[model samples]
Target: MSLEWLQRVFGAKVLQFVMILFTYETEEECNTIKDDLKRNPDLKQLLEKCGGRYLTCNKMMNNQSEMRDLMKKIEHLFNENQQQCYTGEMPNTASIRKKKLESSEHQCGHTSEMESNAHLNLILLGKKRAGKSASGNTILGREVFMSKKSSKSVTRDAAVKSGTVNGFPVTVYDTPGFYDPKMGTEEIQKILDKVLLKCESGPCAFLLVIKADSFTEEEIKTVEKIEKLLGEERLNKTWILFTRGDELQEENITINEFINDTEALKKLIQKYDQQFHVLNNKIKGHSDQARLLLVKILQRSFGIK
Candidate 1:
C-alpha cells in the first residue's frame, strides 16, 4: 500500500513504526526523516499530537546528551502509541529557546579575524597647540573637540571622535596634548596606557603633529621618546603631520622643501620611511585635505582596498 494509505488506515501505528526507525538512526538521519515527513500533511498532523513534545525536544536539544534523552522519550511514546495517553494536545512553550540554541551554535566557530569589520581606531598624538583637536574635528567632519586660544590644553582628557568617512567607519582618538618637561614621564606613560587600551584592535595610523613655524630641539627629543615607547617598527604605521603650514608662506616653501631644510625633521621622516603630510589648519580647505590624505595613507598601509 502507499505510505499515505497505510498511515490513514493505521494512524498511531504508523507513527510508532516511524519513531522506531528514528531511534535507531543517527541525529542527522533523523533530521532527514523529519524534513521528509514535514512535506506530508497527514504525518505532520499525526505528529502534532502527543503534546507536540517531539517538536519542542528537537528544537531544545542542542548537545548529544539532550538528543539521546529525547530519542529515548520518542521510543517510549512509540511503544505505547496504542494507549489513549499518547493522543494529548500540544503544550505551550516559548520559541526563542530553540532560536537561541541555534544562534549560539552558529557563532561558536567565529574568530577575531572574522570579526575584523569593526572600525579602525586612529590616534592623534602630539604637543599642545599642535592642532590635534582641529585635526580630529576635520577627520570626523564635525566639531567634536573644543578648540580655544588660551593654550591651556583644550583636550585635557582623551576624547573619542567616531564617524564614517567614504563608507568606512573611522575612529580618531584625541589624547591629552603632550608638552615636554612640564608633563612628566609618569603622566605621559599614563596617557600611553590609556591610548593602548582604547585602541586595542590596533591604531591604523598615528598622526604626530609638529608646528611648521619652528621645529625645536625639545620637539625632536619628544618625538623620539614617543617613538621609542611605540617601538621603531611602529613608524610603518606612523604619519608625520606638519601643522601651521601657513607659516611657510613668507618663503613660499613647499612641504618637501621645508622637510629637506630641517636636518632633525628630515632624519625623523626618513627613519619613518618618509611618511609625512603638511596640514595647514589656518586655511579654509586644509582640514578636509588632511583627512582625505590620512584615509589614503591608512588604506595603502593596511591593504584595505
Candidate 2:
C-alpha cells in the first residue's frame, strides 16, 4: 500500500490529497506499507515531523486558553497514533486478520491455550480518594475492599482479594494511598515493594485508578511518583481506570470526550498506548462492567480474546 493511503486517516484538515488512496489497496499491500513504515526510520521521522507541524500550526491559530488546551490534548493523541503507526504497533488490517485467525484456532478446542488458564493479577495504584479500593470491589463484583468516603486513607496496608471474573482467576491487590498524610515515605515504599513481588510470577495489569470527574494536581503528582517507581516497562502494563462513571453520565459526557477535554489525562493516556477503562462503583449490578473490563485486559495484556 502507498504511504498516501495511510495518510487519509488524519482527515482532510491534515492530509487532503491522500484521502482516496486507501480505497484501492489490497490486504497484502497494506501489510507491506506497515512493514515499510516500521523498517524505514527516515520515512517514520518525516511523517512524525509532518504531524508535529500540523499540531503547532493548529495551536497557533487558537487564541483562547481553552481552545489551546484542547489543541494540546489533540496533539498528544495525534503524536501517540503517529508513534504507534511508525512502530507498526497500531491496529491495522494485518493485525486484525491475525487476531481473527488466532481466535478461530482457540475456539477449535485449543485447550492447551496458555491464556485460558492464565491468572490475571491486578495492582491498584493511585492517590487518596481516587477510588482505588472501590475499583477493586467493582472488579471482583463484590465489596471485598474497604471502600468508604473519608478524608483519611481507608486502606492502611496492602490487601489482596481474589475471585473469578469473566472465566479468569482474578487477583486484585489494594494498596495504601500514595502521599497519604498519615503515612511516612518509608512506610509507603515498604508497602509498594512487597506488592511488586506479587506481580513477578504472573500476568499482571496495574490499574491506575483516577476519578473521571477531574485530574487533580495531587493526582498528577501521584502518577509521576508511581511512574518513577515502576519505570517504563511496568508502565506499559498499566491501564488507566477512571472510577465514578456515573458522574460523567450525569453530565452527558462520553469518556472519549472527557479525556479529550483534559490535556494532562490525554498525555498520560497517550504515554500508555491509550489503554483505559471506566467503572461506576456507585452502580449496583456492575457485573457486566467488571466482566467487560476483564475481557479488555485479557485481549490487550495477554493477547487473548
Candidate 3:
C-alpha cells in the first residue's frame, strides 16, 4: 500500500504497531492478516482496534461464511476511515499499488550507532571531459585527484576518496567516463561488469556529471542505458551533478530552470521524480551544498533520518 494509504488508515502510531505485527505474527490466521497488513497495515490495524477480529468456526461451511462476513466488515471499516482521513477524496489506485510493491522491497532494519555514523558512497559517471574528476575534487574541498584535459579518460579505473562533510563522512568514487561508441555492445557490457566488480556493491548514489556549457546526446543515451541496466527505481538514488554551474550564473540563468526547459533533461528528472542536484565545481563556497545533497541522498538510500 502507498504511504498515503498507511497514513489515512492508522496515522503513524498504529502503523508502527502493524509493523510490529508483521515482525511477530506467525500463525496461519495471523499470517494471513499480516499479509493483508503488508498491503495496507494502517487499514488492517485500524479495523482490528475498532472491534474487528478474525473468526474461524469449527464447521467448514460456517467458517467460510464467517470469513466473508469478516472481510466485508473489514472493507466497510476501511472505507469509513478512508473517508474520514481523506474527507471525500478517493485514493489513487495506481499509487497505492506502486506503494505496496515499494513497501515490500523496503525492510525496516534497526540502525546501530556505528551504522548511523556511516558515510554515503557516491559514484560519479559521465562521458569523458565531463569534469567528473573536477567535481570530486570540488566536493573534497581540495585537489585530491588529477583532473586532466587530454582526449583519453584520466580515471582509467575506479578510485575512491573519503572525507568528512559537515561531520558526516562522505566517500566519492571517481570512475572512467564511458564514451567509446565504436566499441561493440558486448565490450561495453564487459567494461561495466568490471566497473561494478571494482565498486564491490553499487554506490549508494550516482552523480551524472554534465558540463554546464555542453550537454551532449551521448550523455542522454548513457543515462537512459544506465536506468535500464539498473531498474528505473534505482534512479531515485541519483543526482545530476552539473559542473561549472558558475557559467550558468554568468548567463543570468539558473541551472534548475535551464534543465527544466530542456526536454531530455526534463525526461531524466521525471523518470527519477525530479531528483537532481547541481554543483559548481569552480565555486569554493558552494561545496557545502554538495555535501548536504549527499547527506539527503544517503538518507533516502538507507532510510536513515
Candidate that scores best on TM-score: 2
User: Model 1 over residues 1-305: C-alpha lDDT tens digits?
Assistant: 12333333334344444432233236686677678677977556656543344532333355677678767876666566653342322111222443454467558854332123335677788878778887776666667778766647777677887885544567888877676445776787788778877675554678887878777977877687778777776678888877766777766988888888889888887887777777666554324565566556755556543
Q: Using lDDT, give the best candidate's number.
A: 2
Question: Which residue pairs collide in model 3, if any?
Answer: 1-100
lDDT of 1: 0.65
lDDT of 2 by residue, 169-189 (tens): 779999899989898878888
Candidate 1 ranges beyond 4 A from true positions: 1-115, 180-182, 249-251, 283-288
**By TM-score, is 1 or 2 better?**
2
lDDT of 1 at 273: 77
lDDT of each: 0.65, 0.73, 0.63
Ranking by TM-score: 2, 1, 3
Ranking by lDDT: 2, 1, 3
lDDT of 3 by residue, 104-223 (tens): 644554434324234456678777788889888887777877897887778766677977564455677887676654444465556656655655353467787888775568888877
For each candidate, C-alpha RMSD in Å? 21.7, 16.9, 19.1
